[model samples]
Target: MSHGPTPSDVAAVYLQQGPYAQGHDPHGHGHAEARGHGAGGPAPKRVIVGYGFWIFLLSDIVMFSGFFAAYAVLAHATAGGPTGRELFDLKRVGIETACLLASSFTCGLGYVAALQRKQLQTQFWMFVTGLLGLVFVILEVLEFYEMIVKGAGPGRSAFLSAFFALVGCHGLHVTIGGLWLATMMAQIWVKGFKPQIMRRLLCFNLFWHALDIIWVALFTIVYLLGAGA
Candidate 1:
């Protein structure tokens, strides 16, 4: 029946002690309100943005889960059309995967440069990241073109439709990400490593890395396994 210390009591104590010590969260709100009320002046912009972006990433992953499920269920519904093994080119897929993974690495380096406030290094690394992403997108488009030319387009069969839906969705994200990278590059050029621009760069890094992770799964499930079959 003990309510323990009231928030006012805690606040008074926090004020007396000058904010809770590190590794201390008295009210179990993870020191968020404590910091806010104790002269912390709201959570840092990076933390807020990072948390929101994580939620967005989780929602994106859920959407991709649905696509993966659909592809699994319908991968076999070729209806006399060509199968994945016959249609997928593993060598090309491998190259695409390599490009994406490399872009992820460069994006990480760009993030480091942003943190260090290295203008030229950040721009150079981000430029490489964007170029690699562009290559990946181009390869994806070329693959789609080849598939369509071979009479295995999305309209040709349920399997092809599901394949295109899943793969094309990811490719669309990459395309959007590439554009975002361009925008960030412009922002960095104009604004330098301002807090807001750096926050944006961090979000872009997360988004690009998430896309890379999704592509890995896609390459494994849709490309590798499909190739084996």
Candidate 2:
């Protein structure tokens, strides 16, 4: 005969875990020890989402770290071609860096506004952040345009290739970040701080700040040191 749970057993399961629809735990883990129902899962949806997204961002950071390392090794080894010292413009880089850093700060304010449930403030600050990010990408593209026009394209030298790759990666990140910010603006209008919406917004915040940190490293290595070399 096949063994199966009886109606009384089902009742016992429900009694133990309450009516949260968290489903039956055959192991009888109980409500106090569940994974996401205010137990080991930790602070509800917001915290759990933040934790998961942070993990994703950390993995992305690792990928960027590899890119940075590769760039570092080849940034100055230009194979008898023009080196970073001959190509970089520190003033332009400084302007790009300032735009990016300011965007990050505005993003921070948007996160705070989101947490406070200030819809107007959140939307305004997010728009500001996106605008600043767009500006940064434009400046970076212009810089690249100048380099390419001056015969410093990635095909010209290993250093130039690494330089373009590292900075271009950052430029791509800002472009995507701008899209995400615009999506969030639409989301707040439609979803209005729902747990899932907030989850995504906070996740994007983590990602945006992580990009900023990578930019700092790039600025120091590619712009500051590269220019000096």
Give the alpha-carbon lDDT of every model.
Answer: 0.90, 0.83
TM-score, cand. 2 vs. native: 0.82
**Model 1, span 1-229: residue lDDT tens:** 9777788877876776655465446664555433433466556879899999999999999999999999999988999989998988888999999999999999999999888989999999999999999999999999999988988899999888989999999999999999999999999999998889888888999999999999999999998998788
Backbone Cα, N, C clashes tallied per candidate? 0, 0
Stretches of candidate 1 off by over 4 Å are 1-42
Instruction: Give candidate 2's whole-model lDDT.
Output: 0.83
Q: How does each model score on TM-score?
A: 0.84, 0.82
Q: Per-residue error at 184 for model 1, in Å?
A: 0.3
- Scored against the true structure, residue 193 in model 1 reaches a CA lDDT of 89
